[model samples]
Target: MRELIVTNEPVLISYAEALLKDQRIEAMVFDRNMSLMEGSIGAFPRRLVVSDDEWAEAAQILRDAGLGEWVVGNARK
Candidate 1:
């Protein structure tokens, strides 16, 4: 799996998930429960991840949605 985006903003993650879903791509949000460990201080950014096979498509969908700024890692592969 590869990370599509990582951010402290919950809304951005939600938006990215929605966009990916709209394109028939399934995404997994990691560290969502980290809030419990971090005392809900938004210190740990949630990670949106997808399979390596789906990374390109998922990255394109997010970038098209104007979320390119939040994307992480080398999506080109």
Candidate 2:
């Protein structure tokens, strides 16, 4: 899997997941357990990960949804 978006905003994570699902892309949210680990303090950000083969299309979907700024790493480079 490859990282798609890493963010502190839980809502954005949910929204992105839904968008990806609509596009038939499977995604997983990493660090979600951090909320329990940190006592729901929201300090540790969550990560959205997609399969290696689906990353490019998933990133484009996110970008089209006006979430391009939230993407992380060298996926675009």
Model 1 alpha-carbon drift over 4 Å, by segment: 74-77
Give the C-alpha miss distance for residue 9 in model 1, angstroms. 0.4
- Candidate 1, residues 1-77, lDDT tens digits: the string is 89888899999999888898988899999999999998999999899999999988888777777777777864544
Per-residue CA lDDT of model 2 for 2-76, tens digit only, reads 899999998999999999999889999999999888999889999999999999899889888999889775455
Local distance difference test values of all predictions, in order: 0.87, 0.90
Name model 2 segments beyond 4 Å from true: 74-77
* Model 2 vs. true fold: TM: 0.91
Residue 35, model 1: lDDT of 96
